[model samples]
Target: MPETLRKTFAKWHHWIGVFCASLLAIFCLTGGLCTIGPAFDHWVSPLPPSISKVFHTPSAESVAVATEYMEQTRGEAPAFLRLPTPQDPVFRLIRYDGNAFQTILSLHPETGLPFKDKPSLETGFFIALHSTLYLNRKVIDFIGLFVSLAGLGAVISGILIHWKRLKSDFQLLRLFSPTPRRALDFHLFCTLIALPFLLTALVTGVWIESQHLVEDFSPRPVISVTETESQKNLPAHLPPEAYKELYQAGAHYWGKDNQGFFLIAPHQALLVPSDGKSISLTRPHLALTQIGVKSWNIAPSTDKNISLTAFVKGLHLMRWATGEMRWVVSLSAVLLWAALGAGSFLLLMKQRSALNRRNACPSRSDKIAFSFAESFALSAFGLLPLTLLGLLWLEWLSPKIPLSLSIHAPQGRVDAFFCVWIGLSLIGLAFSLFRWVGSFPFADKALRLLWKITLKGSVFFALALPFITLLGREWRHLPLLPNTASLLLEGHFVLFGLILFMCIRKNT
Candidate 1:
């Protein structure tokens, strides 16, 4: 590349990183956490030790039990039912509990009663953070759209800047080298390693956000409900027996493939097929009445378009990915997080070095901008993981804490997280400003001390989480295998702790 073009690309890359670094890190970390949703769900709400094996209950029977239980407890029928699979044999019914919030109730397959307590708060918290960033759906979609676009630009520009050295430097890493060189190499290595997956995620994310545009531009499909002779003579409502028979018929038709069936309405049901299949989100239903069973097969789109869309979505979301593939995707997300951090670090450090080399007192504006940049970098790299670990600790300790003390378990976890994060941000800002006003070396030492303290505290909490859980609960209540939540938490702590340790060790 020419000198001018290279410099332009480099500038764009650095500014893009500076602009979207925090958001990118948030997305990557949450995306990785979301990939282990099922495992987290299991950890949060494990089966009772009393139930050694799941009972094989009939679908209609389970639905009836869940309905009765919901009506008795919540005074309303559930809006949706998540049918039990072999892996998770408890039926989950979700109801809109007035205020537009949905409450999920898990019921035993045999007795139809709720389990010992509510579902795991940790599971719901992480999921909420991942999906919407705790904001409205449309707002999140808007933010995601812009973030993904900027990310795409960053990735493209980065590749362009590194194209000449791409082959030779792709796998090069010098752990023992100087901090700047090592940081650059590691950043490039991680980016190259996760490029394909990251690109797929970014492109599909953009496509998903632009789906509203597609809907507006595309012609809507017309549907004609033709009444058969039997349907024309049918009663408005089917008897309970007839409904059961209809369910059996639907199960025979689609459930034969071991697909789960969810009750969409009193007389309508939808099938949840195995992952990787191209099926309409709202189609492939069996509608039943007094007359007969009517099956609807409205395609999401024409065969080719829907198939392609579904495939791309599956790749992005990892919905169809197996266990090992999900792990690979999670690892890719981690690498993306590391790459973003390293890139931002390299940019900020290089800028600081440049400013120092000028050998003159910097202006007020320069000092302010550099301070803001340093604080942002510090929050992204340090505060995020610390806040995450703090939340986990809160989740574990909430139950033990007294309600009169002004903290609510599970429900207050999110609030506490924000409180801790804001607190840390304020402290970091103070340190940055302190560094700005004081001598360079003294301020640097103070900042490094703060960083080391924060890192060590995070490490201590992360490493202590599993033992806390084990000791907090009775031995019988513990999982037979290592809980996925604990394992994931520990893995993240170790990975992040190692990175922080390296930074401290290298005096960077």
Candidate 2:
């Protein structure tokens, strides 16, 4: 690369990384958690232990049970039935109340009795945060699309800037080297290691968003329903027996090795089977109506274009992953975020070093901009873990507090997360302003003190999380076993907190 071209790429890479670091970090952490979203749901709200053996209830029966349970409890039938699997042998009925909240009901397969009923907030929160940044769907889609594109741009520019050094950069890490060189080496090492995974994720994210945008604006085909002899003979709604027949027909058409059928419409059902030996994870479906099995929709053609698209989507989403492969993907996401963070931090540090090397004082605007950037970075990095710890603490504390002072269930807890995050960011900004306005000789010390306090506070809360949860009244209700999600989360908090503390202590 020419000197000017190299500088341009480097400049764009640094700028994009700096601008999108916080959003990308949020995406990475939430996306990692969401990769195991089902596990989280199982851990947080497992099936009743009394149901010892899995019951093989027919799909239609399960849906009927779920529908009856929902109608009895919420005075309305569920909008959709998520059929039971062997792994999670409960009929899940989803009901939207035409507002921000939605209700989810899980019923026993055999008994047709309610196992759990709650707002669809807990597991959905992570997914919503990952997909839409907890904003309006339309607005966040655009923002997410832009951020994903910028992330891809950053990755490409970074590769261009480091094209020559790419071969040698992965050789070794020099911890004892000068700060700038060491930071650069560490950043490059992580970037190179996570390059392939990061590139696939970014590219697929862009593709997914583009498809969503297109679908959002595209015109839908209008299908006119003519009153044919078959349509006239069919009843308005299929009876329960008809559901059973439809399920049998659909199952037979798809073979025994299928997931389950979902009621897509009043009289129509769509059956989905497990992934097969192809790049496409999209399952073939058997569509049924009141009459009988209407059509067998085969899987999409395995052409080069379709296969490539499917491969990219499956790779990015890991929809076909199971067991330990999900964990690998989650860890890869975390490492990719680490790479981005390191790159952004190194850029900021290099800028600070350059400023320090210049004997002349920086302009007032430059000082303000630098201070703001530092504050934003500090809050962005610190608030995520702090918010998570805050939510855990709230979970334990909410029940104990008086009704007047208590935060309500899931929604209030989510609100508390945002409150804590915003509060912490404000505090960080205040400290940054103080550091900037304070006496020259003490400014650096003040800033360092701010970071040390933030780090120590975060570590304190992270360490306190497990004990608080265990000793609280809800301990008996929570799953705290070694393999459960509670213990896994607690271990993460302690391990990551200590690592963060040690790193900060050493560097600061």
RMSD of 1: 5.6
| lDDT measured at residue 321 in model 1 versus the true structure, 0 to 100 | 60
Model 1 ranges off by over 4 Å: 53-60, 67-78, 95-103, 212-250, 253-271, 279-315, 358-369, 403-406, 426-450, 473-476, 479-493
Model 2, TM vs. native:
0.78
Q: What global local distance difference test value does model 1 have? A: 0.64
Residue clash pairs of candidate 1: none
Cα displacement (Å) at residue 49, model 2: 2.9
Model 2 poorest 10 in a row by lDDT? 295-304
C-alpha lDDT score of every prediction, in listed order: 0.64, 0.62
lDDT of 2: 0.62
How high a TM-score does candidate 1 get? 0.78
User: lDDT tens string, model 2, 167-268?
Assistant: 776666664466556666756765666677677778888887777788788998765576334344433444445545545665666554355534344333
